[model samples]
Structure formats: C-alpha cells, structure tokens
Target: MSSILYEQSLSFKRPLDFVFTYLADHSHMSDWAPSVTSASKTTPGPVRVGTHFDIQMRFGLSDLSLDYHVTALEHPQYIELKGKGETFSIVERLRLEGEGDHCHLLYQIEVYYQEPVSKLVRFFSPIVKSSIKKDLVYLQKALDQQPSSWKPTLWSKMGDRLLLPGMLHFSKKGFASAKDRWIGVTEDLTGRNIVITGPTSGIGAAVARQLAKLNANLIFVCRNEKKALIFADALEVEGYPRPRIEIADISSVLEVEALAARLLEKGEPIHALINNAGALFNQRGVSAEGLELSFATLLLGPFILTERLYPLLKKAGEARVINVSSGGMYMQAIALDDMEFEKEDYNGDKAYARAKRGLVDMTELWAERWKEDGIVVHAMHPGWADTAGVSAAMPKFYDWTKTWLRSPEQGADTVTWLAASKEARETSGLFWLDRTPHTTSMIPGTRSAPRHQSLLRERLEEYSQKLSAVASQSFR
Candidate 1:
C-alpha cells in the first residue's frame, strides 16, 4: 500500500479544551497512540506550528524512530502533525467540537508505507483498523481517568528552577498547562466523608463546591455558622447534599480537639481531611488563649486535629490528610529553637512561611507515622489565588498580580485531586503543585533539619500535653 488512511470518530463527554489539549501535547501522544513506546517534544512552549518532537515507536517487529513536526494547530478545535521515518511517513490530525461536555472528536491518520514496508503494510491493513478503533476507545478512557504525570520539556524544567517562570506557573496559564496533561479524575464520593476546613470562602469554598458536585458527604469546618449554612444552602441549591457544618475555629486547639471528639463519637470513617484553613498574620499577635496566633492556626491546630482524628481516618482503611501550605513556604526554614518567633524579631510573612514549612515537614513525618495504619498525609500550596486571604494579607502584592492570580477553583484543583484521585493515593509526603510532585525546597537550606523534624513532633506533643493539663474546655 503506497498510502493508507486510518480514521476514526470519537465522542466523549469531556470539555473541548480537555480533549484538544490531550491530543496536542507530545508527552501524551504515546499514551493513546498505538505502538508509540515514547515521544518527546523538542521545542518549548505549547504545541504550535513548527514545533518538533522525536518519537520512538514500534513498527511491527522492528524498532523505529521518527522525527515529528507540528504542521498546523488551532485552539480546542484542530491539530495536525507529520512524522517521517526511514521507510514511513505519517500524518495525524484531530478535530474537536462542543464546548466542555458532550464532545465530538474526529481523529485521522495517514501512513505512507514506501518500498520495503509497502508489502508488510498491505498485510496488516485489516487488523490495523480494528486496533485503531480500540485505541480510540482507550483514548476516551484515558481522558476520563486523567492520569496527570508527564515528562517536563526543557522550558518547563526551567520554569521550576527559575524564579520568574516558576512564579508565572502559579497563574491561570500555569493551571491550563498543568491541566492539559491530566488524564482524568474518575472517582466518585457518594459514600465518602470528607472534612474541609475554612470552606466558607476562597480556595476552601472552591474545593467544597467541586467535591460537593462529586456527591461526597462533606463536613464544613467554619468558624462562623451563618456563612457555613449559607454555603451549604448554595450547594443544596445545586442539588448536592447540604454540607454538615461544624462550627469551630481551626486556630483553637481546644475547638479543634472538641470538634474531633464529636466526630470520633459519631464513629464515621473519615475518607479525607483537608486542613485548608490558613491566615497570614501581618502583625505579631497572639490568639485569645495566649498562643502565637500564626503557630496556633497554621501549625498547632491542624497538627492536633489530624492527631486526634487518627482513629476516624484509619477507620476509612485508605484515608488522606491534605495539609494546605503556601508557595511562600519555599522561602523559609523551620525555626526549631524559636518556633513561636519568640527569640527572633517577628516578621509576619516569615512567621507564616515558617509555619507552612513546619506543616510540610509534619506531613512527611506523619505520612511515615501513619503509613502502617493506611492513612496518607500530603501537603500542598494552593498557588497564588485571588482569595480574600491574599487580598487581606498582602494587599500590594495582590494588586500587582490580581489579573495573573489563579481563581480559587484553580487554586483548589490539586487539593481536590489529592483527596479524590486514585493516583494521589499511590504516594505520600511529597509536596505537589499543578498535580505534579514539586521540589519541596526551591532554595538551599529551606528543608528542615533532622533535629528540627524530631523537635517539631516532640514540641507538638509537649504543647498538647501541657495544654491538656491546663485546658479548661474539653473535646467537643
């Protein structure tokens, strides 16, 4: 056969961008494309005209390599790639329709088998059509499953190592790029019980709404009852279950303990607990109970709540504890000797960063501590989102980056993935951004010392023990 065309039409209930991005990216071409063992993009940036990829593919019983080029491209609509090997030249085209769901996809590929391979191609033609159709079905399943890891291009690697490009990835464009490689999130939470702190606003609210749509039984941890009720009502209006509101300030060890006690009494298996409640203290301050406000809210409270609720988490058999840290944490190291900012001059941002760093350290420690018990602990930063917290905490920074900032939904995406995705459960203690494992330390010496790691747990235990001795309020 001199020229053979294999074409298939596919329809999926996936967004056009979602399908289009998958088809255009070189990292995933091997995933759904038949006989491709590996594929790599040679050019940086999104797939566009003149982009180049080197491909390793299987040709019958022989190993073959091809140089592929992006010949044409259009957004969420069309893609065309042409590849040349020693004996074969191939062209693949994809066209998509519909907005975000109920999608229609057109896929076509033409292989020109020249000279030596022409005879072999003729013999394999019949089986090739059926196999191609099966691969198209596999493509739909891949889109639905949304497995997100991909080999980063050189530019993307630079984005992680460089300050400016790395920070740019925290924006909407970054989310879009990260989202492109995502396979899918197919898990449903109809019977799952998820606990989300600070769900009344910002990233937490976004996470809650997304999980609510998944039919997860959610417990909203909000400091205010009225806002919680209103948020729950909104979800109910969307036809999700009315979230069970637990009124307790996450900053209060006493309140968190009380709340944990109530959940323990309820004896429900908690599938996931999202410690998303956080604040950036501008002034050095103390909570009502005289604890350092930053430490209490960001470190101490989440620590105590996760510890006390260990039983509930273990009950679920496979549970995840997601600690929400911040990208700012990459700047600071854990201050073991001066954990409360007592010995050093207090900088609020430094304090916040330190607490987040400690939380990530704790995530590592506890993942090991609870691994035998079937509980996975993970930490994430919500990226830079246009949340009230950001506006209140860093007004000037917010103003400068507001347009580039991720929406609360984008901010919460990784956390939601961690809580609900099968892929997330495979690993624990790794810090993540954009559904990919990120370097826990961007700068030298930001990682906690082994000594500090030991002290973090010991000191937390000491605080809990000492507080229990003096705390007047009991567990809720």
Candidate 2:
C-alpha cells in the first residue's frame, strides 16, 4: 500500500528562536497537538537527534501509545521525528524559515500501514488530515503567545507536593504573572464607548480604569448612584473624561430593561458591553422578578441587557460582550432543572458557581449566535484576585492565602486584554485566562451536556421576553 502524506504551512509572528524552543520542548507538544494526552522526552541529555519521546494519544476510541525518535535536528531550521506502532508507522518533519522577527513553518506528515491496516488507515486519511489542520491552528496560536506563569517551575512543583491543594487550584495568579506579553493592554480606544457594570470597586473598577486611560468613553451601569458619582469624580481627577453613570439595580429585570432602554435612546454606538456586576450572597435571596439573586444577577441580568442591546452592538460593526465569571465555576455545571436551587438546600458557594457557569455557557452560545452579526462575546475568571469582594465574601479563605492572591489589575489583565486587543477578536466563544483560552471544565461532572446549550438559550430568551413585556405594560 502507498504511504499517505499530508502537508501544511503556517507563519508565526514571533521570533524563530521562540518558535523553535517552544516546539522542540516535547512537553509543549501536547499543548498544541490534538488528542496528545502527554509527550515526554525519554532521553537523558539535551534535545538532539536520537532523542526519544513516549507519546500517548487518543485516536477515535483507541488509546495509541507509541515511541518516537528524533531523526534530525537543525536548530531554527528543520526537525524530523519518526515513530512506529504495531500496525502503523509515522514520520513528521518541520521546516523553519526565519525572517526578521517572524518565522515561517512548513509541516509535513507521512503515515504507512501494513496490508489490512492500510485500508483502514486510508479510509480515515481525510479525518486525520482535518484533525492535523485544526491542531495546526492551535499550534500557531500557541507559538504566538508569550510564555505564561503556568509553565512548571521547581517552586510550583514543590508547592504542589507540599502546599495546601485548594490554595492553588483556583488561583491562576499563583501561576500567571500580572502582565501578559502577547496581548497589549495599552492599545488606543479613542472614539470607542465601553459600558461596564459594577465599576465602583474590585475587578470591574480595575477594568474601567484601564480602559479609561486608553481614551474609551466610559459608561458605568451601577446600582449605587453615590458610589458611581464618586468613582466618576475620581476618574475625572485622574484626567479621564467624566464617565457616564446609569444607576440601575441589575438584579431587577425592570431596572435592567430601563437601563438598556435609556442607552438605546441615546443612539450612541456601544463598542463593548461588559456584564461585570455580580456577587455571591451569603444566603439565598430573590430578585424583583422573584428569581434567585445569584442566578438573576450573574446570568439572567446580563442576558437581558445583552439581548436588549443587540442592535446597538451590531451598529458598532465590531462590538464585544465580556462576562466576568469566577474561577469558582469549576465546581459546578448548569443544573437546568434545579437552576434556581428551589428543590435542594442552597450552598452559597455552589449557587454562585452555578450562576457563573450558566453565564459562561451563555457566553459561548451568544458568540455563535451573534458572530454573523459582528459581535464577539467571551467569558473569563479573575482567579483569586485580592479584592474587597473576596475579603467580604470569603474572609477566612482570603486571610489564609492573601499573599498568593493577584492584585485587582493582575486579575483583570485578561479582561482588559480581551476588551482592547484585535487579536482577541480573531476568535470568539472561548473561556480565557491570562491572555489565553482555558478549558471551561476542569472536573468531570462540571461540564454542561451538549443538549444544555439550546435549553439554556431558550430559557434566557424566554426570560428576556417576559421582562420586556413587563417593561412595556409599565410604560403603557
């Protein structure tokens, strides 16, 4: 049987040294390569020709375990790797060209199989090629990013063994630096209008401050008129334009509707709508609409506002919607049936997490629904940021790990990055942390089922319609 070959060429805007170093490290392969659960260097010395890698990958439903040997290594130029399994053999090569600060990469793969396996392999060739193409997109993105603090260090490894587990589990700041190299935070936002909720304090305030410095017209949708005015005065003192403050309790569907209507009446383009006003109540409470407070504030409120402002977002031509969720969402999935937590006892933390998870689910859902309408929607977690909200809500936990926490600006870096960067607009419907896409679910039971997408979307639409109808009757 004839050997199958596939080829792809892509360019990385990063330095050749950066590209080569990142790819040459076997451990980084799994970060970009599809279905690669792990890649380890079995050799004792530095990476060079003859170095061996034990790779474990999942193909369809089968676990593929294989050993690959480096056949050739020419720094900043070429690399070739060969692997053999019981039924098949493989070879992959990379050709690199460096130009100024950019690198061009040419990747090629060849696969050969024994008699009966050949038929099966060829039959799957299209799928194999498609998978590689998809993986290459991820690889290119990986190459373009600056190294994050998530890189394993001796201290972190030791901490993993010795330190308290829960302390670092949700703390991205424990691993990620306050600054990001890939996404620039100082981009100009002149002539842009950015609407942010809960800008009086915490991560939302930090995000507002950063965007203001970039010359964006700031609109604060806040509950406390006094605090909103005070914060607006502070921004003006800092030489920022007087921020527009719209006082509305976001948890109230009527207020959310009123806020959106007021903004719509202004006829000004909305460059971005940041749904950042959210809180975890120590006890379960009800909104004006009689929905659970966490659910209403975190998910339903944002949904209604975004839905009402859909036309305005499209008017801006390339608007963005950013949902500020919490890393605490890792523990919960969308419990659609018990979404309001009416059936069981409500744990404050779990209630808060479920609300954030629901919002995250909607972020992805909205991005897909609105992509053709020119709106980019995304969701992100602050990752144990040292903020007043944390101190008040989880005082004991904050007191214990205060030193490990990131500053408000550090935690808001990804949010600011996503808000201002053109690169971030390239892809939508992703959960982000430290300027890169992160997995939405880290635990097995924490992911929403495939069917939950439409169900949640429909539910939010129903809520939006109900709220709009109420607002209409009140007006009449």
Candidate 3:
C-alpha cells in the first residue's frame, strides 16, 4: 500500500476558546464539510476521546458509508480520527492555537490505499491535493461567518467546499464559455411561476426563452404594454406557452404597488422572482416620483416589489429570489449618506455600481433572516454580456470590452442555476457565477469577517422601513 499526506492552515477572527469548543464537538464537522451528508454518534454521550460515529457521504452519485473512531482528544488543542474502509484507510487530525482575538487552525489528512489501487491514486495525487486545499478555504470562510444559531453539521462544511470554487471562477469568466455545460445539468425551472422584469430584451429575453423550454409559467413585467405584448407574441410563435403580461413602469412606486396588488389578487404564488429590469442613464435623471433614476429603478423598485410580494413568496414554499448584480460593484464603496448622489458628483457608472452592491447586500440580509421560512435569496453577476443595453448605453465601453463579453443566454445561466437547482436549495445570500458560489475580494484594510454584509444589512433595513412607511402613508 501507498500513503498520501496533506496539510493546511487557516486563521479566523474568533477566539481560540470558541474554536476549540467548536472543533471538539464532532457533530460540528457536518456543518462545514461538503462531502459528509450526515454524521451521528454511535456512543450516546458528549463526544470525547475514543468516541465513535458513522458518517454518510455522497459524491456526485456514489455513496460512501464509513465508520470513524476518535483516536485522540486534547481539550482546547487537538483531535484525531481514524477511518477504515474496504478499499482504504484514512486518518484526520486538527490542531488549534490562540493568537490574541484570532485562532489559527491546522489540519492534516493521511490516506492509504490497497496495493492494487495505490499506484493509480498516486498518479491522481495532484488533483486530490488541489481539491482538498480548495475545500479548506471554503471551510475557513464558513466557520468565520458563524451562521445564525444552528447546530453545526458536516453537510454545511462540505457544501461550502464543494460549491465555492465554481462560483468564484465563473464570476471571473462570465457564462459565455461555460453556459452549455451548466444549463440543463444545474437548473430546471419546470412547472414554476417565474416573474421577470424587463423580459422583452437582452438578458431578460434570453432568460425567458430558457425558462419557456423548462416549462415555467412566465409572468413578464415591462413598462410598455405594446412592447410586452409583442415579446409575448414572439414567445408563442417560437412554440412557447403564452406568458402572463403585467405592464407597469417599475421606477414608479404607484405603478409597482398596483402591479403587486393585481398579482396578489390572482391568488397564485410566485415560485421565483427575477429582479432583472434596470436602466443606465449616461446623464443624471430622476424618476416620476422625483427619486434618482438609477436608485428608483435598480434598488428601490425591486425592494418595494419584494416586500409587497413577501406573502406570495412565503406561500411558494422553498421559493427563490434572484437579484442580478454586476462585477462593477467591486470597484467602489457604497455612499450610504448620498445614496441618491444628490449632494455629490454623480457618475452614472458609479451610481449603477452602488445600486448593484446594495442589491447584493440585501440578498445576504434577506437570506439570513428568512432561511427558516424556506425562502432562498441569491445575488449574482452575469459577467459582461453583449446586449442592446450595453451597446446603446455605452457603445465605446462595449467596443473596448466586447472581446470578453458573453451572450445574453450565457449571462443568465448562473441566475437560472441559483433559481432552480436542488444543489442551491440549501445555499442562499451568496454570490454565484457558473453554477458555483463565490467569495468577493475583500476591501483593503478590512477584516475577513462578514462585517460589510452586516453593515449593509443594517443600512438597508433602515431605508426599507422608511420606504415602507412612505408606502403606507401614500396608500391612505
């Protein structure tokens, strides 16, 4: 037999005591591991040295049922486990050290295979090492966040490792080159009521086509009734089922309210809501309500619609809400004080970028608050897509960036994946691309903790409450 050993180290802002307590509990492994589906103790008391457990794992379509015996345990310091299988033997160890307010964790894994398979496994060592390293990074991120009060499980840890990379890579590459591979395999919107804004053109139009093929009952929202009808007619001509059309200028709060009321009156739950409608004005502009155009159309409109339709979303049970964000959000910090840019110099690109960032932030907040209700909210960047909007709004920018841009269909793949895939059911409030969840680059001088997400959530909730009050007063 031949053996392979791997080691990795990660640091977290949490205290060493917290890390030790968390690691000492074997059941917490399931919370961060993507491979281990379920973990349960065979010996009924608190986990300690010599405790034994059975772990269930499913990779792709293969089932791995294994028994693990705890070998060593040193409180606030180290743990070791050994697993024996028909084909292989595995040993795992973890060590923790305290450094002020931070904790450093070290992990080591050793694997041995039977003689006949040893050589083959050695040849695949590079791949395995790479996979394990990536998994560790995800595990670190999940542990750092300390998800809302829930018993830590191995499945959660495994999910972080399995889903983060593809999402990160896709965020960088967009969907053009990877769409066909991820489309049907990752997402299926069949038999769902899918509400989409801006369904007549560009990315919106492409998404409608894909959903039609998936047999989704489509609800198309657009400002121009004639344009919406035309798009609906085209879908029918293309052998798609007739979609319901709702004509309302999303930038107008009154119109948005009426639209929500009409949908609620219909008494049918919306299985998914895609907040895809938005415009980029090269010059400063204001909506009919006297709000900044980008703010009203991109952030406020979607926020209002989502709030009004919360009941329907809850009724859908395991429903999704996808916010189409942008890569540009990374370029600038949000100006919360001047969100409307009324007092400062307002560049369209800056305004658009901030709006997208707000959307991403809100998605995370909503997911954290609503997970128990069975609702999943996700934010995603479509990469650079070659669309009419791009060409019309910034022809020069499009021309400069066209070489890397994807088709509209390509841009929509991740959005569809997050909305319809079973793999995505447990994952929410994260950014995705190419069917994988991704981590955004950290802002300079910022701690790795989810501090930005927390701040955004606070600000958004405050603003939303104000908007809700305004809405109530208007109705009266």
Candidate 4:
C-alpha cells in the first residue's frame, strides 16, 4: 500500500529552544496538537528513543487511541515518533531551527494502512491532510498564546548559549573595571524621582531591584498590594533599600493621578518614569476605561501617566523616561483610525503590536519635546525574558521558542543599563536592544511622515494632549 505523506513548515515568533522543548515533551502533545485529545506515557519518563505513549485522538465523530513510540531523538534539532493502532500506523517528525527572535518549525507525517484498508486510504488521504493542517493551525495559535515565561526542556541551557558571546565581548572590552564600565559614576540626579510601573514582577521587578541596589529612591507602582509588599520585603532582605510602594492600576489615569498626588505630597522631584507594565491578552477584552485592554494597558495608560507626571520630570535635572516596548511591534503596522478596535474585529496580537508601535512613536516625540528640559526619553524592548508574562500568556509560542529566549536577568540587563548606566545617560530619543542603541522596525512612508525621528515631537505633543484630556475627564 502507498503511504500517505505530509510536510509543513511554519515561522513562529518564539525562539528555537522553545520549540524543541515544547515538542520534546510527549505530555504536552495535547496542548498544541489539535487531533490529540490526551497523551499519556506508556513508559516512565524521559522521552528517549523507544519510549512509548498512548494518545487519544478525535476525528469527526470517530474517537481513536494509538500507541506511540519515540523513533528518533536528536537534541535541539529533531524528534520523530510512530503511532501504531489496530489497522493504521503513523510516523511524525518535528524539525526545529532558530532564527533571530524567531523559530522555524517543520512538521512531517506519513501514514500506512492495513492491506484491505489501503484501498480506502487513498480517499481518506485528503481528510487526513486536512485534519493535520487544522491541527498545525491550532498549534500555531496555541503557541502564539504562550507566554515568554513558559519553560521548555530545551531552554534550560539557553542562557549559557545566549550570554557567552556577549559576556566574552564585554569582558574583552574590560567591562569588569569600574572606571571602564561606567558603573561607579554618580551623576547628579538632584531633581529625579523615578516612578516605576509594574515594579512587582519580571523585567520591571528586576529593574526596580537593581535601582534599589544602586540606592535610587523609587516609587514602585503596581496593582497587587501583597505582591508589592513581598517585593519590597525581598529588597530589604537583599540589603537593598526598600522602594516606597504605590498601589495603582496603570491602566487607569485616575489611579495614576492619585498615585502622582501622593508622590507630590512627598515633595520629591520626578526624574525618570519607566512605563514598563504591559499585558498580552489572548482574547479580546476591554478595560475599565472602555478602551481596548492591550491598547489601554500599553499605550494610553502610559501616555496619560507621562503627561500627568511631565511637570515633575521637567523639574528634574537630566531626567530620563524609559518606555518598555516589544519586538512584536514589527509584526504589524499601526491601525490609527481603528486604534481602539471599536468598529473592527479584534486580535490580541495585532492589538499588542499596534500599542507598542504607538509607544515607539510616542517615545521619539517625547524625547524631542523634552530635550530642552534635559529629559532624555527612549524606548526599549527587553529581550525575550523567561518571565511569567511569557509563559502564561503564550504557552505554545513559549514552548516552541524557549530555546532562544533569554532569562529575566539577561533580558532586564539592557533595561537596567538604560535606566542608570552612564553610557546611556547622554543618549536620548533612541531605541535599545541588548544594551545597544538600534533603529526601529518602522518602514518609511506610512500614515506618519517618512522620517520617523523628525515628526516625533509633533506627534507626541498631539497624543499627549489627547491622552491628558482623557485623563482629565476620567479623573473628574
């Protein structure tokens, strides 16, 4: 009987390590593979070659269970499995490749039927192909939903691989020396009081911790009061000065104003405001302010907060405002007219991308306007960090790309450097990746002007006024 053959290749936004790890776990088959309703190990653990499992699959009204065994295991490269059942046998292979900030996955399958059933297999080939294709699409969607923090077995050593070259380069450049690395310099932050949003977890938490260690008095703003307390306590335990906890929902302009008022009462000059809290919703949702949740969380909220805090930032000497954006901004262009998705279909990923692009534009605008105040503003994409935000939000993507994802410590390294390092002190109105300045992914000649930097000031001022108006109404 002729065997049915299938092959498919897909580009995933996650890292190569993440792909390998997620596919390597037999237990997770049901998580991404749509046809597989459940997968259980027939052998103990460790899916080495020859390890077997039982997988239940549902195709149309027919429910089937197949005994599967790992036929091939090559670390960080490929996995092949074969499933045997009463009258059918199936072979599946998953191949993975790492691309910069993305992963490529190739899935191939073959099926053989019993001699008598072989005659019917030809007619069923299309059905089989359609089912598998549907499965792959579902898998891709599943991965896109995975968070940056999802741990795949293959990513355990990713940090060692990712940092080796960078660390070696830095070491060769004499980064260890205090004088050479600009770690010891204490430039006057006389007017600067930093407001760090989402200071409780992931890159924000790490940045806050590092700032506290540097003896920077910070107002740590977050929604979770208990988590904030825990974080403050952790800092105290680590011998870092405890930053004052300011409870507020950054998505709400009113909360931001209230928090700002409390800080103003303390009479501290605001120097830097790190708008770092962000969300990636897999499904469509709206915030309390009636704005699309991702838009509100990432762009609108930060915009309003910055406007409310602009006076304080201007009062500071050489103040800096760092906006945390994402590389996902490259995925899509700005939907200016339908920014709020009020009249259009909503997609979480596109919503996030739009918000981030807006953020980048806003960063450039603010940097240009605030230049006179010595307030250097910049936006940064914290490298793919292994944080809960990634794991929980994008499990399938995390699983597939975990291999190339950086640890939270490694990801936050650039953010911390931008926030405090003297190397970045003089540099403003730029985007940073891996602690080095880089240009944005914006293409020339969109709805906005061709030269992104040139038009930033005007755009930012316009957006700032709009956001401020929103805040004023919301607060009242």
By lDDT, the best candidate is 1
Q: Which one wins by TM-score: 2 or 3?
A: 2
TM-score of each candidate? 0.71, 0.65, 0.61, 0.58
Question: lDDT of candidate 3?
Answer: 0.72
- Following a full C-alpha superposition, what root-mean-square deviation does model 1 have from the true structure? 12.1
lDDT over C-alpha atoms for residue 92 of model 2? 91
Better of 1 and 4 by lDDT: 1
* lDDT by residue for model 2 (136-202), tens: 7667766665333333345434433443543463464343322222323334587999999999999
lDDT (Cα atoms) of all candidates against the true structure? 0.82, 0.79, 0.72, 0.69
How well is each residue in 214-262 modelled by candidate 3, as lDDT tens digits? 5689999999889889878876764567899999888887778879989
**lDDT score of residue 254 within candidate 1:** 72
Give the per-residue Cα lDDT of candidate 2 at 29. Answer: 60
Tens digit of per-residue lDDT, candidate 4, span 1-476: 66889999988776676667567656556544656655656675345788888787777767688998888989888999999877789999998888765888888999988888888887889999998998777667655543112111222123223544333222211111111112221222322467899988888887775566446777888999999998888777654566788898877656766777676676677778899999898788877656578877888778778876777777777678899998777556666657676777777788888788888888877787778887889888775667899999889978976766655544565566666655666668787765555546534432234364344434445655665577668766
Of the pair 2 and 4, which is ahead by lDDT?
2
Tell me the deviation in Å of residue 373 in model 3: 0.9
Assess candidate 4 and give its TM-score to the true structure: 0.58
Candidate 2 TM-score versus the reference: 0.65
Ten consecutive residues with minimal summed lDDT in candidate 2? 177-186
